[model samples]
Target: MSLFFKIPFDKKQIELAIESLELQTSAELRVYIERKKKNQHFSAFEQGLDYFNQLEMFKTEAKNGVLIYIAYKDQQCAIIGDQGIHQYVTEQFWQQQNRLMIDYFKQKKYNEGLINIIANISKELARYFPYQENDKNELDNEVIIK
Candidate 1:
């Protein structure tokens, strides 16, 4: 019963988050970004939604790492991570947002509207999987349905 976390996000953030995961040395990982079929000509938002839905197909797996989702709404973007990495990543994301805001403020170009939008997106990304403790054997026995 390894805990499962779900992140609903948008594409650019998802790409950066994946890059951050790749920097981790202790985890074995695989990342799937939903690619829009070139011939279909879907809108960017539609393509992101398709990828997010595709992630649901892997919900049953109990691997010892994370999965991510990227989604969009109107002009906002989001990133969601699996339970294994949610807390750490979400915290890091907020920290990053603060840094960005500070940088903008320091330049005396503090755009309140832009900052609020970023904050809103970050808030949406902060959702996490409720923690659950599981035995080693139980984790090992878990299966991911494709």
Candidate 2:
């Protein structure tokens, strides 16, 4: 039973959000969604890191890739940032963003919540890693569903 159809967001909306974010920073942001969990014991954060690695997020020249992993059926999600982003943002910042997102999810505002979250992250990324003339989007903006 894939929850993919039930998830309110369309890939284009997420892609547009990522595109807007990347226009302001060299940093990359990606979204990954899955219908269910592979292991009940694994936390969303742990599984996010696995996909982050598999996506080669850590290989960014600036180490500024960010991943938003969601298990729609489980109603759990995690946001992960590479070391470069960690240097600029505190744990509390991430927690705050998570809280905000959860609040929106509770209201079923998936599209609005994710778009806003990406915008918030873009501010920090722009501050620390402002876009360069030669900067290219090194990561795919296409949302992934698995």
Candidate 3:
């Protein structure tokens, strides 16, 4: 069983999110970032749609027994799998973003507003992958002589 999370945050935000995930107890975790070509002939909207289609393909490739999480500016979605990573992201992150938006609106800090939203999302992801105590003594002591 495997777990996957996809967040369509800004490039900087995504990098920060990945850095946080790297600190988890699970060292074999995999991460991928989707890139859009600038020379494409389509409009921004069309490019975004194409990117989503690629995401769907990635999800299918993830197969069964895998958990998936996705966070975009307009939407935040998650998929959970049994016997795999537990689901943790929820609506609260968005709620927090709303609150931050209000504050940013008052301060007129548009860039800060976006960064705040992504930071909150990253925090939520961090909470999902907490540190687990390692127990090496649970292994069997059986040995075979060849």
Candidate 4:
């Protein structure tokens, strides 16, 4: 599936959502849209981790990077947060985000799903990794369509 054709959500909306979220928090947030079919040999979680590393999400200054990875063809997505944020959030929190996203996806409301997820993540990130004066934006707001 091509990123252009498979992702039903508007690229501009997604980028705006990301920008709004990151502006309020110091943590880096990125959305990666996978054009390839989900690898049968790996679970969504594994594939997400792979992309997270490939994108060097773990290299953030505060180690508070988060990746929202979507495998559109497989109808699966994964939310991965680096250790700085993970250690403060509970597993249940992550599960809840996943459930909400899955629910929206089932209804073909991909844009709403991503916006909600980014909002929720921003709240948590603000709580733990509040923006500091010297904090720098570690990543781009552009949605990686690959």
Candidate 5:
């Protein structure tokens, strides 16, 4: 069953945001939305971890993949960073990003929330993994909806 009474963000808005963010850095960011997993007991973080692998986020040349997983029906979400990015950022940084998203989510501003998070992540990525001459986009910019 579709859970959202009002769509969080239009598909083009998300895609353009992601594409714009990606242009500034080498880090790969992907958003995945699932409507309540069949295993309803799984936590948002766990599901995100599984999707990180299932989505082949680890296959990047620099291992710098980030996943923003949202279970719309359950109103739960997790932001996951791959090993390359995690090594440079602290746990607190991730918490801050998560908190930022949650704050906007509370106000029903999913689009702004995502754009803020993406911009922040792009800043950090640029600092740690600036784009190189040969750096190609390793992941798709589209938001995955299921």
Candidate 6:
């Protein structure tokens, strides 16, 4: 319990990264960190999906929301995209990101690794969901630590 009391990035940094990313895309992004698995029976992705719905990430107008979920004590991570964005990108896209994170994680570069991953995801989201003049910030950019 409480293994990740001190995470790599702060609220300001995460908000800034998300703000910069949102300026270019209509998609929403969120990061959730927790001390341990709430349900040991669930895989990281399933746990993420549960939060995705609980957080109403599926309610975005364009159905474009991404959640990066991490459980530190459990040593698990899952990045999930809602249906709208998922259909456009292939499964391999997600796998590549997971691999990218694994490399950075092994090097203990959590902040840098997450920022890079955010930037990469931003590019894809912007490509497919470029910001519209009337686009609203559908979700809060704040990183969630639970």
List TM-score per model, in order: 0.27, 0.92, 0.34, 0.91, 0.89, 0.91
Scored against the true structure, residue 115 in model 4 reaches a CA lDDT of: 91
Q: Using lDDT, give the best candidate's number.
A: 2
Each model's number of backbone clashes? 9, 0, 0, 0, 0, 0
lDDT order of candidates, top first: 2, 6, 4, 5, 3, 1
In terms of lDDT, the poorest run of 10 residues in model 6 is 1-10
**Which portions of model 5 miss their true places by more than 4 Å?**
1-6
Candidate of highest TM-score: 2
* lDDT of model 2, residue 108: 85
> With candidate 4 superimposed using the best TM-score fit, by how many Å does residue 71's alpha carbon deviate from the native?
1.3
Model 3, which residues run further than 4 Å from truth? 1-86, 102-106, 130-146
Task: Determine which window of 10 residues in candidate 1 has minimal summed lDDT.
Answer: 137-146
Candidate 6 per-residue C-alpha lDDT over 1-146 given as tens digits, one digit per residue, 9 for 90 to 100: 55546766566776788888899999999988787878889999999889988999999999999998877656577889999997797789887887787677767777777788888989989999998889899898889888
Q: What tens-digit string does per-residue lDDT give for candidate 1 at 6-33? A: 3232334434443333333222222333
| Global lDDT of model 2 | 0.87
In candidate 6 the C-alpha lDDT for residue 84 amounts to: 98
Error of 4 at 60 (Å): 0.6
What candidate 6 gets wrong by more than 4 Å, as runs, is 1-4
- In the range 74-144, model 4's lDDT, one tens digit per residue, is 77888899998878988788889988887888898888998999999999889988877877878888898
Clashing pairs in model 1, backbone N/Cα/C closer than 3 A? 5-83, 7-80, 9-70, 9-71, 9-78, 10-70, 10-71, 10-78, 61-144
Among residues 3 or more apart in sequence or in different chains, the pairs in candidate 5 whose N, CA or C atoms overlap within 3 Å are none
